[model samples]
Target: MPEEIASRRSRITPEREAELHEAVLDLLREVGYEALTMDAVAARTKSSKATLYRQWGSKPELVARALRCTKPASLREIDTGTLRGDFHRMVELSDNAQMAKDTALLRGLAHAVHASPELHQALRRLLMEPEISGLDEILRRAVERGEIAPDCPAIRFVPHMLIGAFIALPLMEDRSVDQAFLAAFMDSVVFPALGV
Candidate 1:
C-alpha cells in the first residue's frame, strides 16, 4: 500500500473513507475543484463537515486524496526486460481509452493545481514525481542492458517526450493516442533517437 493509504486508514473506517473519497471525485468531475466545497462533499457522502475537516484538514488535501484514490494502479511497476518491451508497457498502461473518461476530472485538477501553489506542489510530489521515477527506472534498466548509451539524450528526455506527446496531442488536436501513432512514435522518434 502507499504510505498515504497506510496513514489515512488509521483515521477513518475503510468503507466510509472510500465513500467520501468517491464522493469527492464525483464532485470534481461534475462541479470541478473550484466549485467543489467541503459542505457539498459532506452532503453527498452523508457525512458532516467536521468529519471532512477532521480527516483531510483542507480542500486541496481532500482533492489530493480523491486523485490519489482514483489513479489507476497499473503503472506502479513495469519492468519488461528490454527497452522496447518497457516502452510498450508504458504506452499500454497509459491507454487513451482509459484517460478519455476522466478528461473532466483532469481538467478540474489542472485548474486547481494552476491556481494554488500548495496544491501544485502536492500534485508534483504525489503524482508526477512517482511516475517519473518509474520511467527513470525503466531507462536505467535499458542502460544496463546495453540497449542505449548511458548518456543518450533520448534516455534523458524519454519521460518528458512521452508525457508531452500525451498532453500536446489531446490539447492541440483533440485526438487520442492511437496505436498507429504509438508505433510511429516508437519507430521514428523514440528508438532512433535513443540510438537503439
Candidate 2:
C-alpha cells in the first residue's frame, strides 16, 4: 500500500462509522428528515461538524449512508421448507424494538423522501429493495414447491402488503409492531394472499 493512498483515506474505523450511522438514524427518528441536521448528529456522536461534512459532503449523503447501514447485514436465513414458515420467520425477525425503531425512522422520513430525490433513491436502495428481494425469493421457492401457481399476479404484491401492514399499524391502532400481531397477520392476511 502506498503511504499517500493511506494518508488520503478516511481514518474512522468501521465500528466508529457504525456508531455515527446509529446516531444519524436515532436523530432522524427524533427530529425527522427535514428537521434533522449535521449539527445534531455531530453532537449525538461526539463528532466534529467539519469531519462529517468532509466525509459525506452533505446531509443526504450521510443520512442515506446511515439508512444503508441499517439494512440486514445479509439476506436473512429464509429456509423453513414452507412459505408460511418462511413468512413467519421473516416477521418474527422484526421483533418489537426493531420494528418500532424502523417504523419511527420511516415515519419521520416519509414526508422528506418526496422532497429530496437523493434521499428518496437512498431509501429505495437501502431500505426497500432488500426486503422486496427477500419476498421474491420466498415466493419463487413456494412456486417451485408447487404451493402456488407461477402465473399468479398476486405474487408481486406480497412485499408491499408486508410493508404496508407495518406502516398502517400505528395509524389503525395506537400500537407498536410485535410478534403476536405478525403471527396473526400471517394467518389472516399473508396466507390468504399467497393462496396456500
Candidate 3:
C-alpha cells in the first residue's frame, strides 16, 4: 500500500506538488481545518480529488504534509556552537508575518487535532517528532559543551517552553511575538531555566 501510494504520488512534478500544498495551506488559513475539504483543495489547485486522495490518502495526512512543507528548515541544520546562539538564530530565520500566520493556523488546528486521531498521529509523525528530535540534538550538544549539566532536569521541558512561549503570546497579548520577543524569551525563560 505504501509503495503504491509512493508510486502514484511520484507522478506529479515537484512544482505541482508544491502548488497543491500551498493551495491547501491557503485554504486552511481561510477556513480553518474543520471546514477545509478535499473538494475545495482540488478546486483551488485545478487537480482532481482522486489524485489528491491517491497521493495523500486522507485529509489529515494531506493537511499534515502541507504544514510540514511550510517549515523553513529542520532544526538539526542549525549549529551555532552555543545553544543560546542557535536559539537566537532560529528567531532570526523566522519571518514575523509567516510565523504569525502559522501560529494562527496551529491554533485553529488544535481543536481538530483532539477530535481526530488520524490528524494527531499524522502531525506527530510528519511534523512534531522531527522538530522535537532536532531540539533534543540541540540540548545534547549543549550538554556536551558543559554549558548545561548532563543531568539537567530542565532538558526535558525545553520544547514545551519554546512552544508555550509561541502559543502564549497570541493568547495573552492578542498579537504574535516577533523575533525580538522570542529572543528575549530564550534569554529570560529558557536559558535561565537551563542555567546557561
lDDT of 1 at 115: 86
Better of 2 and 3 by lDDT: 3
lDDT of 2 by residue, 1-196 (tens): 2565345336788899889998988888777888898888888899899988866768887897888777554345687998878877776666578777777777778789889998887667756777678678888999999998888877988877777677678888866678888888878987887788
* Candidate 1, 29-113: lDDT as tens digits: 8888789898999899888898788677788877877777766663548887898887787666655665665554676578677
- Model 1 alpha-carbon drift over 4 Å, by segment: 1-8, 13-15, 178-180
**lDDT top scorer:** 3
Q: After superposition, how far is residue 136 of candidate 3 from its true place, in Å?
A: 0.4
Q: How accurate is candidate 3 locally (lDDT)?
A: 0.91
Q: Candidates ranked by lDDT, best first?
A: 3, 2, 1
What is the lDDT, from 0 to 100, of the residue 105 in candidate 3? Answer: 90
Query: Model 3, 23: alpha-carbon shift in Å?
Result: 0.5
Let me know the TM-score candidate 3 reaches against the reference structure: 0.92
RMSD of 2: 4.1
lDDT of candidate 3 at residue 82, scale 0 to 100 = 92
